[model samples]
Target: MPRYGFIAIDDRGREYRAVDEAMSEAALEGRLRKAGHWVAKAWEIRPMLQKGGLFGGSIRVPTRPLTEFFLQLSMQLKAGIPVLTALSGEAGESPHPGLKRVVQDLSERVQSGQTLSEAMAAHPKAFPRVVVNLTKAGEASGNLAETCNRIRLYMEWQERIMADMRQALTYPAFVLVCALAFVFIVFTLLIPRFAKLLAELNVPLPLLTQIMMRTSDFFVHNWAGVLGGVAATWAGLHFGTRLSPGFALLVDRAKLKIPVIGGLWCMIGMARFAQNLGVMYGAGIALPEALGMVAGLTGNRVLEKSITELRQAVTEGRQMHSVMGSHPIFSKLVSQMIAVGETTGSLATALENVSDYYNEVLPRQIKRMFSLLEPLMIVGLVGFVGMVALSIFLPIVSLLNIR
Candidate 1:
C-alpha cells in the first residue's frame, strides 16, 4: 500500500499531521474521517532515498525505551486509562524520537477507530510479531493490560540476556585484539629488522628464524590480499545467510555445535522459546499458535525447524510432548516436564519453569566459559610471543658465537 501524508482536524479541534498507508487518497480521507478527524488535505508520500540498501532506512530505538513503553502502557491501562489516552500520554512524554513518532502514529490510528493491535501492526520495528499477536489475543480476551505486562517482562529478560552475553565476550575480545596487535608489530616491525641483521651477518639461519622471516615477508608483501580475503569472506557469509535459507540453516546448526559457546547459544535459544511460549500461552493464545510464535523466537533455524514440526504435529491433533520428545533439541527433563504440564493442563507454568532454569544456567555457563577462555588466551599469547622472541634471539646468539 502507498503511504500518504495528511493534515486532519480531530473531534477535539486539534490538527494532526502524519504519514499513514492507505490504498488511495479517498481511503486515507475515509480512514481519518472514521477516526473522527476531518481531512484538511492529503497527498501521496514518495519514499525518501535510504542510505543503505535494505538495512539503513530506519533509526534503531533501543530496547529499554520500548520495554519502558510497554510497562507504562500496561500500568496506565491497568489504572483504567483509555487506550488512546495512554498512547497519547506515552507519545507526549517519550524522550526517544523514534518511539515517540511510533506512539504518536499508534495514537492517531487508535483515535481513528483502529484497535491497539492494528495500530501496532503498522510499526513492526517497535512492535514485534509476538507482541502484536499477544496484544491481539489480549484485545480479543479483553485483557490487554496483562498482555502488555507480559511483553514488558519478556523484553526485560531479553535485554538482560543480551547484556550478559556482551559482557562475557568483552574481555576475550579485548585480549584477542591485543594479541593481534602484538603479532602485527612482531611481524611487520621486529622480524624485518632481525631479517636485515641476519642478512648482514651472512650466517645460516635456524629453521625457526627462517620460518618466522618467511611468514613476516608474506604478510609484509601481501597484506592487501590478506585484508581483501577477510573482507570477501565476511561479505560472502553475510550475503549467503540473507540469500539462502538452506545455507543459513546450516550455519545455525553449526552454531549449536561450536566448541565452548555452542551450549550457551542452545540454552539461550531454548530459554527464549520457552519464555515466549509461556507468555503467549498465559495470554490465552492457542498452543499451536504459541508454538508457531516460539519457533520464530528461537533465532536458530535448527530449533525453528523442530518447533515448526512440533506445531504441525499439534495441528494434526498429535500429542505435543510426544513430538517434542522425539526431537533431540529438547532435553529429556524438558520433555518430561512438558508431558506433566500437558497432563495437568498447566503447560504455561511448566514452560515458565523451563525458561527460568535456562535463564539461571546461562549466566553461570557464560561466566565459567569466559573464565577458562581468559586463561587459555593469556597462555597462548605469552607462548606465541615467547616463541617469536626465541626465534629472533637464538639466531643472534649463534651468529655471535660464530664471530
Candidate 2:
C-alpha cells in the first residue's frame, strides 16, 4: 500500500500531521474530509533504507532496547497519543542507532496508514513472531496497549530463563576449559619430556607409562584434527536441522530423552508451549488456529509434533487434553490443568498456570544440575590428575629400585 504523509486542519482550525494510505490524493482528501478535516499538506514517503539499519536489511535490535520500545509504545498508546506520534517519539527516545532508524521507518509507515503490527511485521528480527501475532490480536480486540505490556513481560521471562541457563553452565564450562588446557600442557609438553628421558634410560616402561606416551603422542600430532572434527560435527548437526526435517526431528527427540538434562529440556519446551498457547488462545484466536501459532515455538521437534497432534484433535472435535495422554512430553499436571480449563472454557488461563508451574520449576532444575555437576567435575579433575601423576611417577620408582 502506498502511504502519504499529510498535514490536516480540523473544524477547530487546529493542524495535525498524520499518515494515511490511499490510492491517490483525491481518495485521501475524501476520507479526511469525512472526519471534518481539511487537507493542508501531503507527500508520499518512499523509504530508501527500508526495515533495517545502515549495516543491512536485517537489523538485530537488542532485547533491552526492544523491550523499552514495546513498553514506551504501550504507555504512549494508553495515554491516548496517536500511533504515529508515539512512534515518532520512540524514534527519538531510543539510544540504539538501529532501533532509532527502525522506529523512524515505523512511524513513517504508520503515518502512511499501515497498522502498527503491519509495520512490525516488516522487521521480523527486530519484532518477534509472538509479538507480531499478539499485536495483531490486540489490534483486533482493541487491547493493543495491554497486549504490548504482556509481550514485554513474556520477553522478560524468556530473557531470565536464558540468563539462568547461561549462569548455570558458566562454572561447568570454566572447569572443562581449565581441565582441557591442563591436560594439553601435560600431554604435549610435560609428558613428551618425561617420555624422552625414560627412552634415553633404555629401561622397561610400565604399562601405564606406555599408554601415557602413546596418548600424549596422539594429542601432540592430532590436536588440530580433533578440533577440526569437532567443528565439522557441530556444523553438520546445525545445518542438518535446517536442511532436513527428519534428521532434525530425530535429533530433537534424542535431546528430549537425555537422562537428566532431557527432562529439563522438555520442561523448558513445555513452559514455552503453554505460555505462547495461552497468549494466542486468550487473544480470541480459535483453538486450532492458536495451536498453529505455537507450532514451532517449542524448540523441540517432539513437542512440536505434539502441538500438531493437539491441533488435529481440536479440529476433529476431540478434547486436546485427551490426546495429551498419548504424548509423554506433556506432564500429568499440564494435562489436568488444560483439561479443567477446557471444561471451564478458560483454556487460556489453564495454559498460563501450566506455564507458571514450569517457569518456577526450570530455575530450580538448573540450580540442582549445577550443584550436582560441581562435585562430578571435581572428582573427574582429581581422577585425571591422579592418573597423570601415576603415569610419570610409576616408571621413576621402578628405575630407582633397579639401581
Candidate 3:
C-alpha cells in the first residue's frame, strides 16, 4: 500500500491535510469522497519514518487482558462459529471499555465486507504488528483460530517480561528521586547557613569546603539556565529525530553501545523478533514476509538493519542459521538452535522455542538486576547524604570552638 498526503475540503469548505494509505490515486480519491471530503491536492508519501512519543504517542492504549479474548475467539472459531458473530459477541461482553469499543468498531468494519486483517490494521494502536500479520496469514491459510491461540500464548509471555522489567526499573527510579531531593535540600538550606557562619567567623576555609561552596554558588546562580538547557536539549533531540531518520538511526546505534541496559535491550528486541517471526511462519507465512514484518516490529533501527540483511540472505537462499550467526547481537546458542531447526525442517518451532527460552530467562535476569540495584541504591544514598552531612557538621564544630 502507498501512502498519499492529501489536501481536501470538507462539506463546510474547511481545508484539512491528511496522510492515508491506499492502493492507488483513484482509491485514495474514493476514500476521501466517502469520508465527505473533496480532494483538492494529493501527493504520495515516499518514505515513512519510525517515530514514537514519550507516552507511546498514538500507539499507547489502555491495559487490556487479551488472553480471554484470544481464548474465546479461538474456541468459538474452532467450534465452527463465524468470525463476525464471535467479534460481535465479544464486543458486547468485553470487560475493558477501550477494548470493547475497539471490538465494536472492528466488528462493524468486518461485517461491512472488510477482511478481518483489514479491520485490525485500522486499529494500529490496539492490535500490534504481530497480531495483524498473524491474522492476515491465518486468514490466507484457513487456520485463524490456531494462530490466535499461538499469539495469545506469546502475548502472555511478553506481558510477564514487561512486568518484570518495570519492577526492575522502579526501585532505581525511586532512589534517584530521593538522591536528587537530598542534594537539593543540602544546597538550598544547609549550605547557605554554613556559608553565613563561616563568613561570621572570618576564617580561611579548607580546599574541600571551598570547592563545595563554589559548586553550590554556581548551581544557585545558574539553576534556571541549567534547567532550561536540559529542557532544550531534550526537546531538540525529540524533535530532531522526528524530522530525520538518519538522526534516529544514529541514536539507535548509540543506544546499543550502552552497557548492561543495552545488552538487555538487544536481547529483548531479538526475542520479540523471533517470537513474531515464529508466529508468522507457524501460520504458514513465507519466510521473506515474516522477516519483513519482524524488522518493522523490532523498533530498533540497528536491529531492523540486521533483520533486513537476514531477509536478504534468505531471499538469496542463504541458510538462516548461518545468517544469524554472522550477527554479534545474536547468541551462539540461538544460532545453533536455528541450525538444528533448519536441518530438521522445524524452523518455526525452533524460533518459538528460542523466544520461550528468552521469555523464561528474562524475568530471572530482571530479578537479579533489581536485587543488585536495591542495595547499590541504598549504599549510594547513604554515602552521598553522609558526605553532605559531614560537610555541614564539620564547619559548625569549628565555629563553636571559636565561640
Q: Could you tally the backbone clashes for each prediction?
A: 1, 1, 0
How would you encode candidate 2's per-residue C-alpha lDDT over 1-403 as one tens digit per residue? Answer: 6667888899899987777689888899999899899998887654444544334554668888888888898898899987788888888889999899778878776765678888888787788887888899989999888888888877888888989999999999999999988998999999999999999998789898899999999989999998999999999999999999999999998997788888888888888888888777776667898888798898988889989988998899999999998887778888899899989987778888887887888899988988898889989999999999999889989999999
Model 2 spans with C-alpha error above 4 angstroms? 1-56
Question: Which candidate's lDDT is highest?
Answer: 1
> If ranked by TM-score, best first, what sequence of candidates would result?
2, 1, 3
TM-score of 1: 0.87
TM-score of 2: 0.88
Backbone clash total, candidate 3: 0
What lDDT does the true structure give each of the candidates?
0.86, 0.85, 0.79
The C-alpha stretches of model 3 lying farther than 4 A from their native spots are 1-63, 397-403
Which is better, 1 or 2, measured by lDDT?
A: 1
The pairs that clash in candidate 1 are: 35-112
What are the per-residue Cα lDDT tens digits for candidate 1 across 1-403? 6766677889999986676889999988887788788998776533321112135432456899999999999999999999989998998999998888778767766665568887777666667888899999999999999999999999999998889889989999999999999999999999998799889979888899889999999999999999999999999888998899999999999999999778778877888888898899999999998898889888899999999999999999998889988899888888988999889988888888887888788788888989999999999999998899889789878888998
By TM-score, the better pick of 2 and 3 is: 2
